[model samples]
Target: MVHTQEYESLLPTKNTKHSHRRRSFIIIILVTIAILLGTTLGLAYGFIYWKSRCIKTHKHVQLKHVLPGSFGIEFKLHTKNTSDTSTENDITIKWEHEPKDIRYRQKTEEMVSNDSVLTTVTIVNNNATVSYELGNETCWLNPDNSSIFEWYSILPLIMESVRSNHREDGCRERMWTTTYNGRRVFICIIDQRISYIRYDNRVAQSQEWMVPSQSSIKLPSDATKCGMMDSEMTSLLVVDDDKRQNTSDSTRQQLSYSQTYRKDNEYLKQPEIFVRSAKPDCLFIHGIGVKSPKTGYKSLKSMSYWGHIEKNTPQCSSHKFIQFNTVDNGWDSVSLHKMFCEFATGSNVDGRISNKIIFTHSMGNNIVAAALHRKVCSFDVQSSKWFSVSAPWRGSKVVLKLEDLCSGHLGPSHHKSENLLWLVLEHTKYCTHEGKMSPAYRTLHPTYKSPTGISYDDLVAVARLHVTGALCGTSPWGMGLSLSFSGTLKFIQSFSHLDQPNDGVVALNSCNVFGKKFQSIAKFALMSVNHLESSMKFGCRKPLCSWYQIL
Candidate 1:
């Protein structure tokens, strides 16, 4: 109905293609604006959400940072006040940078589990400190042998962040911004002396990052300037920060647990070197009661002595004899197992395999047996002949006597005796009336019943023989040689007379493993020899050496 300007007609031809192109361009512009607006709004909403949640109080809690190592990877702990309204039993503090769906996460899953807030959580005291260490999950090592790596070359970036915050005087200062538990607690250096950061962060959020403001500062401004040696000296002064009281059953239960294995460089000395490349003729294991250093020394000496012996053997004319330490008698059973695992399997220490030999021994033979039952490492017991010399297949009477002398301070024999007595009383009080004893205790004959089917009868028999021999001074190396042999004969006779098949000292019926299994599973034979039967007489050897015959 209105008059159009002449320029409108001249501007473009009114073709359908031109109209369609114009409409498409407009739609694209609208979509682009919508996307930009949505992105901006979402970012704003997220920032607000994070700020709102950042300062919220965890119920009945005060905050503290007890993290070890650098200030950057600060470890935090909080104390929580318990109330009837709270359902959780334990409180744990952990670090997380992103949601679980993130592609890379290096911390232990238990440290970050969402369900950590369950009813099993233990209540922490007002001054408890939480601790954690950061390690590289990506580092690889060859299990067969030691890998060469510079010990200090691999510090993490998180440690670097904390290093920047270290105070003078070698103390690490940790400060707090929020009331995490109930108190506004902070973590300072455990020891200002040896304060090289122990905790490290493996992941990086970005190529360039700013330090977080919330982390506490490390104290003693001079702490960061010391050399590596000085750092260790400073660290010696710092005590452990974990002070969670024994409030929960689980925490209390951990009292009996072993500490994690930490290697002591001073303890690692060169092992006894056997220069020979050939297989050893025989390996000997001596009994317990060794001087600590002598245990290592004798282990090495065994190789040296065996090498000399092998040179004289008929089998080797030119080949050298080599020996390796198997089970050293000095270590306790626990220490023995741990050492074997580290050296044999390279579970912790970078160890190598170098020795294989026919086995022989005294008390240590039994330890070898115990190690086999435990299957502690990659040790192979089935490949060699095991010749046991004066083996204690049963509980040792000597072990009990030595223990009684010490009033139960040392040795396996004492522990076993105590356990036996405890089991006996428990069975008498709880089981005899109902005839419903736990199979384990009943099988052990805990109540010390009559001689028939009574398990302790074997223990008693061994003890009695031990006491008899003690009066005569007649053990294997005792002063009375003839009486000792007679006692040995008596011990053997008792075993044969038992209605139950026994190991002459321990019972064979129970199938309880002996201490000789380190060599027992191998092909072995026993023989007696004495030093006097040397030098050929008309190319004929003595028919019987009296000392050897007595043996």
Candidate 2:
């Protein structure tokens, strides 16, 4: 190794003329070699420093406890190198990483390889190649890019349409805010040259590497946001996150969630959601099946939807389940809205809007979605926390499936399936309009971009805006209990594996309020339970004490 010496030679000044002459030829050669060496070393060091600051990333790192999934949905945030064509960063998401239910019927036809590719994208500038596994059949999200890998969803479009709305107006159309362990620590919609905070990992200013996860995380996949022809599905997460940040802006203030103290003496330990100082004023909205109940939740306790909750907390209790005058009839959005508004608007502090927590199950969520969107909103959306149980955000293609299955689509072989057919048929009949879907059902049906402007996504947004906070939670009975409604669901999922994971009643994604807006929303901890199980506690037949956990 040739080390450059900075010290001065003391004897050099006194060196003889003859000695200096002889050494001059050798000195000239050494000087020439040293110059070439120094130049080579300087260029190599500069390249290393630039790459470290711009493209450095750490993999599989731990993150702070936030939600419950404790895992992250990975997103590539590096600037594409147009000059380099390296395949070192190519990633293939495996189908097997997701565990399949044992009770799931084997679809022998759509045999998925353990290594089957899921993400669809086109690569031009040697950007990392990422693949995903979103069930059977190749998903076509952005017909132009060919896959999920190439195209970004709604936020990018909203950013494009309304560039003046954002603070980062200087950013380009493809700009992405640097996301961290499910949090946006720093948002620079410019390039990799900006600094970011990826949770515990401290990085140089230029790295755009992603952080890890905790809970409440979501990804941009067409499976969850599938066939989004409707404005609702396309814009489920389009609400600006900044509005949630402003404190003084008074039209609609967002709720901030913090851990709370639960009362042990309470009769029921309801699933935790939202951030609140005191117990909420509880309102239980039952499902379509319970619309014609013989009596209210008091009579059908623990049996009907919303029946899991107690009538009243022991004096000075946490919440009160609001009782409304009921008549036996199928659900109609207009009537339900007026009735709900009257009961909810009763003279409480601030008229009708203070410390309210609304709980809806199955079809009940459909109505709540409508009520939140209506112009004459009576129910308090600002000071309330909304819980949606088993809501179908995207419309389910259940026309033939519901009718055919009741008519022996399973061939009467399974006696267990035969018994529940009548019950299923009776419940489904109420949702049909024009021999198919009622107006509310149409909102939940797969209309995909109709001109009528009925959108479940807009429903999601309205709740986010008006309510202090909201969450959509339920157990997807992917594999149902043998002699129950889940058995019917298991049968449907058996044949329709490509529909993606669902709770037999609603697809998992439909009930989940996650994505850019919700900020990597975590998976429900109650994954072990099914749709019907929501009425009862997790792992017991008693009243529901637990449903949606942080996990």
Candidate 3:
């Protein structure tokens, strides 16, 4: 009985020892797993933080290294009157930035006007500062109305002038209203270029008017005066009543001539080499489908026809016309950039230096967008106006679909026997898939690389106009149909993925820049026009003529 008791006790101790060892092994495994998980999470977080720091540092370096050229100024007129009936025209503001010359001194008194209401001013002179004075407040303005300024329409022009003429020592200012000795007083002063603002007697009491940077202004419209008339010389001056009356009479004479020519049915004239204008220079860039004549290949003659029409128009007749030839096989943004940069730097065919206004169609729009984003063109020295028609700002689903079809060999087996069909399909694949590295696709893709280093706000420095075609009919028979059945089918198939109101070739939504949408100078939607007809139709010609007249 003593031996049996001892054996039972010894069995319990042995089993207990094994149990303790098993528990210790499990505890070690759990601790090891916890440490590994903690290490993985820490490494991931550290990598992300490092990447963010590099990006921030790169942006800081870019901004710090910006070369000074032209300076811009923003003027805000504040009234203490809290009344809701204040008119923006109640305060007359005038300013000028001019190089010291005889003509400038002579026009000084005429330029300083108290009768005009101007809220925003831009100083383009690299060497001179802008000067402004406010006129006596009128009864039409309520001192308490805080939103009486009409700065919305003219702010883009001011920002453009400043950006185009950026200078390190450029005078920048923000103005506001405050109470001085219980009376409403207006203040005009320069914004100090610093990290923070200190409100002293020199600044208005309201700190809200202080802008962080001169380039940070939010423009309400894209109608900029970058390459327009000289604001400093012409905008500030009020023309004499007699001179205005004479100008009105002359304008009527010109209108009468245009009306007579239209009534006589002599609108379409034979193509001729028209004399180039001395003032504004205009350049026309065709889309991807339009091959350059220089390539000695099948080219679209549509731009040439449009050129003839523009030359006949009264407004565009005097403006110089510049035609650019893009690559015939595939549209490339880098190639377009090189051509535009060369043209901007070189004198025109007429051997004259002038400002430019670019008109682009389809893929040409993407080319210009990429070039501007890359900052390849010297916009500060050669300002420009951009008009984009049927721009594929977003990548077209048609290209993606085509890529899949080519990759999958989904076409009819007989297509391999048809040489023409095979040739067309191969060319399409080459342009769309093989040319994926091209800047054109790079700009349109969702994962587009940002080359500008600057934000989309910087693009507002150039005036932009967008024109889209909508309300196209689903007509089965047209010139475009006879040329390529597969192409026509592709165009029809594109509508399935597109938003309503799309041109046969491009969707309206695809034409607009996503995320940072800049307000267009004008947006025109053409009704009852297909893709080909949009470029070839008669009604489409009229709006462009009108735009030229306004310019």
The most accurate candidate by TM-score is 2
Error of 3 at 413 (Å): 5.3
Alpha-carbon local distance difference test for all models: 0.26, 0.36, 0.34
* Residue runs of model 3 more than 4 Å from their true location after superposition: 1-279, 290-314, 318-332, 345-355, 378-384, 405-443, 450-496, 513-523, 537-551
Candidate order by decreasing TM-score: 2, 3, 1
Per-residue C-alpha lDDT of model 3 across residues 1-551, encoded as one tens digit per residue: 99999999899899999999999999999999999999999999999999999877644442112312233322223321111111121111122223211100000111111222222222222111111222321101001111111132222222122111222222354322333222322333343221111122222122232213433332212221111012222111222323322223422443342233232112122112323354445565555543335422231223432334354334332333334444342333455565655555462122222355555666666655555555565443234345555565655554544343333232333221122222334332223334232223333443344454532333222224322211111211112211222223323333234454345445545654432232212222222223443333222223333333343
Candidate 2, residues 438-497, lDDT tens digits: the string is: 333333455545343547677667645543322332223311121223333433443333
Winning candidate number (lDDT): 2
Task: Give each model's clash number.
Answer: 42, 23, 12
Off by over 4 Å in 2: 1-278, 293-303, 311-332, 347-352, 378-382, 406-417, 423-443, 448-453, 466-483, 495-498, 516-526, 537-551
Q: On a 0 to 100 scale, what is the lDDT of residue 268 in model 2?
A: 34
Write candidate 1's Cα lDDT for 1-551 as tens digits: 13466657756766767898988999899999999999999999999987767644322222222333222232222212111111111111222232211011112212111211111111111111111111210111001001101011121222122222334343445422222112221223343322222221111122211233322221122121111112212111122224212323422222211011111111112112224555433344434323234222322322322222332322222222122232232212444545443433345233322343422232344444444434443334332223333333443332212212222221112221222222222221212222232221222222324222223334333322221100000111111111111122222222223222222222222222332321222111111111001111001111111111111
Model 2: worst 10 consecutive residues (lDDT sum): 101-110
